[model samples]
Target: MTRSATTPRPDAAPETAKTVSTGLIIVVLAFCGTLVSLQQTLVLPLLPDFPNILNTSSENASWLVTITLLTGAVGTPIVSRLADMFGKRLMLVVCLVSVIIGSALGSISDSLMLVIVARGLTGIGTSLVPVGISIMRDHLPSDRVGSGVALMSATLGIGGAVGMPLAGVIYQNFDWQALFLVSGGFAVVMLVLVMLVVPESTVKTKGRFDYTGAVLLSIALTCFLLAVSKAGTWGFMDRKTVSLLVIAALVLCAWVPLQLRQGQPLVDIRTSLRRTVLLTNTASVLIGLAMFANFLTSAQQVQMPAETGYGFGLSVIETGLVMLPSGILMVAMSPVAAWLIRVHGPRIVLIGGAVVMALGFVLRAFLHGSVLEVMVASGITSLGTALAFAAMPTLIMRSVPITETASANGLNTLVRALGTSSASAMVAAIFAAMSMDGMPAVPRWEAYQLVFWIGAAASLIGALIAAFIARPQTIAEALRVPGEVVATERHEVKRPEAENEVVVGGVVTDERDRPIKQAVVTVLQTDGRHVDWGRTDNAGRYTLALPSAGRYLVVVSADGWGPMSGLEDLGDADLDQIRMNRRLLLTGHITDHGDPLPQVMLSLIRHSGEYVATTHADTEGGYEIGLPPPGRYVLTVVDHPTGRTRSRAVQIGSTSATLDLDIVTGIPRPRRQPTEDVPVR
Candidate 1:
């Protein structure tokens, strides 16, 4: 088979080469991410000056920022899907080039329309963040994945926070065009670095690009966000705003079923709806709104005049300086965020982040009397933002297939933009409507405080939502080349409508309450002879048919797990009546000629010496198995190629048991004798 330039050849790199290359790859990708984010904050300090410079009304000049938001929201999923289809590094290069061209255009443009178009082009690069993440996952070693992802995610906050102060200083000293020129220069440097260092993704989803879905989604997002962003200027009830809302709603209603029918959809609505992915994305939206609330309000708060009684009366440069600590905090805390994800699941990290963010806003609401106070509060929230941002992508990656990681991550980023737009509109409306007669045309201090409280509420809601997210069923997905399935999805076995089978059912879970996926629960006669059997779903729920209801033993086995056996009286019952306690625990290891052999398949053999259930040994050749009833059974190693077999006669008890195998010659194949009990074929 021929290989492409982007696909990493398994035999090409030594372990040392991969170790050295992975570090440079992470740095280059993160730098590119940082540069892309600089654009998000680069326009903030220039917004007020743009109207006069470009000879446009303030409303039209606002498009300089609005256009970017609109385009970024629409570009994320499209660029992500493209990356998966073609290659991640290839698409990232395209994104960086777009940013360079956009920045260069804005630097030279004198027309307001030209500048807005330039900003829109720059927004297309926002897809870089998610695609970069997909690239890292595809390339990084398993142990390094958490840190690399954390650093990449933190670039958003770092760029936004650091860019503000840097933008302020540049604006104070140089021409307005210098801002775009500097950004353009940064993009160029990053483009070069990415081309030199980042490897192309080997995980490709080969399919026709969903052009129709792309267009439909872009229209829906653009209309929906435009309506939200303009709701403050145009009355909420204005015909334009209402019309956009109607069009967006109608488009989405039709888009859902269309995507469901397509063979290669731009977005997988089914995967997105998985409990883990759905809740995490929902929390992402709320957290984005909460994070944006800080961006929307804090800088303005410090720049407000002191006479307002709550304003800090700081200059634009000083305002950025004050918020600078939080940006640094974001980058600094990345390792900590990564560590938390490695030790605890992303769900726990997400909950902690949401609560921390809520507390930061609560502090801002009551304690905005001093810049020091505000800065400290901002730092707290930034820490939370760092944690949440890092954890969100990990959750998305764990839940999505390798083929769709980029696309799924892209959809998540788009949802986050929705939150940011909502925050802009919500904060704008609050401050505008609550204002009384005032100098500097600002609202009452209470209005600013109220926005913080609303932000706090959003964070709390995010925390609540995150608490309910379930962990992924199987082992977290690992990055693999295209066509390698990392994890198997648990789907229920459909039963016939009018079946007369006596059904027994229960849920199997590990010690941590996570479902033990791919477990086989066997229903055997009272003497460890199989009668009927079924496998557990990804959720670890299983149902088996009982040939007759007198007495039976159930055994459970999963890959890397030891066998579990228990006794239960079906007692002539239906599905609801069978509630076997699936709590047996057994552990063991497989070795060949005294050397541990991982990935060996083991079968749970019956007392009849028949293979009934199967499992695989893990990386260390260790396995854990849970069983239903404690009984004597023969565990066999079904070595296919060698055809050498080993068996261990083991008895399970109320507690856990261990049975190790050396597989030397064979364990004499367990002295089998013919049984009178009917053998399950």
Candidate 2:
């Protein structure tokens, strides 16, 4: 059966390993995700001492944090795309190795520059969260996917909450190298568990990696993130910050149009444009900004000197302990959030979560009588963040194709990171400007209150946006599975005959060179045996495995476009891009007893009784309907005014044609010959 042009081609059958324990896989993946999150905060307690320890300026020592943010921002999309193209498990393992290497190097080195390099390498592991989530979607049963995603996402909060206290305890007992040692050790264990428990995903999109797109996106993200992160220190209007922001904006302006035209884009911008996805991502940014304010200020509130009138003067360890309950609340709320999502849908959950977060932030803005009060309010926000974060991946996965889960989730993760970066900048700026009057002034109580109020506002705005987000229209859309293997059943050649097939791939485009998505490219052996067939992805690229790299017939077709076929010698070389010039359509006139039947309805159906398209005759009796791939079809015309109807069989070939139908006798009338190219009044 031919694939429908208007719908996504059926996915390949899911490939799962029955021996792998799903529970064990979730444990390993969530643990790894938590480890990655821990890396972000592990050095927070050490940041104050880093300058003296490494004999470097405080500004230079900050690169340890800044570099990772840069690398993680740049790496998330690229690594996620590679995961979709390569095996998810393979990328998972690669990411784990990078973490292990970076951690080990940092554990042994004291040089600021070397540790920054190590941290940059470790940052690559941040992408493993999305890839792991994709693996859960591929392997977990439909009933368990929500919970698995919640657990994975909750790790972001879990590790941040745990990292500071854990770092404090370790720093007081041993040297700072111990922290890296612990992270590297956990990575090694997680890597082994991943290989043993997590099954490799079978779904992969076939295309050449879009290196140019990747490079451009990296430059853009790096510049933008740098500007936002450094704006507090450099001044918002400083030339350096402004130049970076300008460069980032200019690069994005060029990058978007290029991605739209690319045969294989690193990020699927078209899917991102869908209402559900677009709004969820927007809400993600706001929710992220609001949620991070709790993390940023909760411990600081506890550590403030008692003389500040709203201070507790707690030790670093004590402050970390005080704030740890918020992370615990996040974890405890995961199953609750998942249950909410399963019942009311992700959109409702997101909105509810945002509302909850907004209320929590408002409470934080006013309820700081003691550490206990601050902890309770922070925990409430964390609970809401658990719901919001959990719902985002579900919304994204449901809206995007199964093959693109990693990259789509990666983009969402990237946006959330953007929100957090902005939050960091805003918090720093607010604190710096609102300092109390003293030699070494501290931020006044009002600064913290202002941040909380801003968080509340961001949360409410996110909730408002979530209210407008569209939900998936069907249950099947929410639960996409790799259905059937188009590769195995569709191939005409015997499986044993093509043991050593080589992969050939290219893009499909129209006459105007616009990429045509959902087009099918079929490869056949010279003697009429079909080696393999593939469908174009969102970027209009397709791939086929040809037997033994010899000569083969390549056939490309789409529903409304003319079919094209040619023989080409297939090898390791890239196939030439295929272009289809004719957008076949059946245009004709409807008549009744030799008179025109204007404003009549027409339907095009296939010979096998499948619906193709519908159109209506214009005032001049002319009607046009797009034709499907070359086939026998029946065109029916109905005149509503006279209650007359007619049906005629049509044979569409590789070109456009015209016909005229006689409704009175149910017979087709001959088409009129073309008139001369002369002006008519």
Candidate 3:
């Protein structure tokens, strides 16, 4: 693949496209994360009216929130596994598109069932935050990874905090449908931005889609979440709840063994067993429960009738304002979490976050006097939630292989969602059991205090679990400043006298046996001293001039490929048997409205439903992307100016090919041909 200086290289990666700033990338991902989470609470303020609008009972109307929780919990792990197998960006966009379509459907729907279904579709967006975090780890440089992941993780709190107030304002001034309309619009914007900015992950665990595992998991989670959600309404010991729990338990018993035997399980049982992953996930579930407790209780605390003594009697909009500080704190604390993680490791951060959450709950339990106190307490819990969330992903990344990062995080997110679901159920059940003595509809201040205490206990348990999580070497490395000196550094003898600069190196290739040009190959002497290093060229070949070529450990690494190391006994003769495998790459082009689209953004998406790469169209409308060979990809052309975009799924092979994109309009844009103006209706 090497080219002569005089020859024109085929699609030489545009100089402008060489390196994108990590800051911009994280900002896009954080926005997407915020949008995804914002959908969760967008319908919060509109729930009461559902009974009237859809002509359904209050219980039936509550399904608007319930269905979303169920879907997010059940769909997250499934979508995550897909992301791990295919592409993270692709799945993220798919999740967002589902939200857009679902929002669009609900915006016009009069049927209660249809609205519930639309809300369920919106729930899929919850998984995007995890997938985005995984994408950050894959694409962001090492130095930027912590902060990028921190911001992405914090969006969950940020979006949830913002959603309620925003929805409240819209409900007051506009139709309820306006919420869905606005949500759909935001999702569309997020979709375009993600496709433009994020790159698809090259690392993937290739295998057949696990339909059985996916189905079993969906069934198990649905049963479990459904049961938890209905505990307050149906009674904890009701037949329906008992039956659902039984079904979940039985299905899980069978599912665990089934995954253990699968060639490629949906939730990799082996990786999940790792102490770090296990404890981190355990903490995730507990902290998720504690974190969501604040969300469910804060508004009620502010909106209670003044007769209750603890009630501020604020409107929904006013309650939202009171909770605004909580969201602000979450956003503000994310950088602090990132700093702590960089300096002290994610394990410590997880534990610290849990402790902070417990403190927040404890503080609220003891200081429930005024609106200011309530807001301050809520802010503390939000800060803690931000930290815990920010650490969970980092812990998962360190525990699992790069190939499994997305799925693992997805599974972790699923666990957190389950916890959040539990929080909802727990809060409802507690309030239902301990209501105002005279008025059955309201709960006393003491009841709220009890919930706070329970949240504190849950967080304390999370902190305990996080403290037990194993510390991975990667975290250890990250905790130390890059230039810090190690007092225990091993000493090695200088071997300059035994020099034999006869190049003893070979090329690196991907799993498909194609040369992976420009990969870094390093050689260290048997005594553990860094001897030499170099990079592969256009042909994925590297030549290392070793010193005295005794047995040495060689390590090879590329951006998209997994890091590989092996022992090699290099000598003067016959030194050409080194090769490495990496993920595949593909390339393409794009055009706009009937002409070349210069500077337009394009996303190379896999048909399995994940994004692979983001590239810009050249001055002549030419663009290129990288992907694994022998799979399908959807080339997306994003024309921001016209908002007329195109997405067509296409298949490709081992070698690169030409695929030009055309402008498309899902929502009609102004046509080039002039049309007669119509009279206003």
Cα lDDT over the full model 3: 0.75
lDDT of 1 at 332: 88
Minimum summed lDDT over a 10-residue window in model 3 is located at 1-10
Report the C-alpha displacement of residue 520, candidate 2, in angstroms.
9.8
Candidates 1 and 2, the one with greater TM-score: 2
- Candidate 1 stretches with Cα past 4 Å from truth are 1-12, 15-20, 472-681
Clashing pairs in 2: none
> Which RMSD does model 3 reach against the true structure?
22.5
Candidate 1 lDDT over residue span 252-356, tens digit each:
988888786555678877678989889999999999999999877888888888888888789777887888788788888889988787666678888999999
The CA-based lDDT of model 2 is what?
Answer: 0.79
Native-to-model Cα distance after best TM-score fit, residue 553 in candidate 2, in Å? 26
Residues 1-681, candidate 3, lDDT per residue (tens digit)?
A: 111112111112233135555677889999988887788888888788889989999899989988998888888888888897787889988999999999999999989989999999998988887788888766665456778888888877778878888998888898889999999999998888888777765445455777999899999999999999988899999999999999999999999998866656788786698798989888888999998898889988889898898888998888877887787778788788887876667888889888988999998987778899888888888888888888898888765655567888988989888898999999988888899888887987788988999999999999998888765342222222112121111221212333222344455666566776656777666555555565555556554444344677777766544456767666534444344443334444454455666788878777887867787887887655654546776777777887767777666654435565556422212112121321111
Clashing pairs in 3: 89-611, 90-610, 90-611, 91-610, 200-612, 510-582, 584-627, 585-627, 586-627
User: lDDT for each of the candidates?
Assistant: 0.75, 0.79, 0.75
* lDDT: the better of candidates 1 and 2: 2
Query: Cα RMSDs of all predictions?
Result: 19.0, 12.6, 22.5
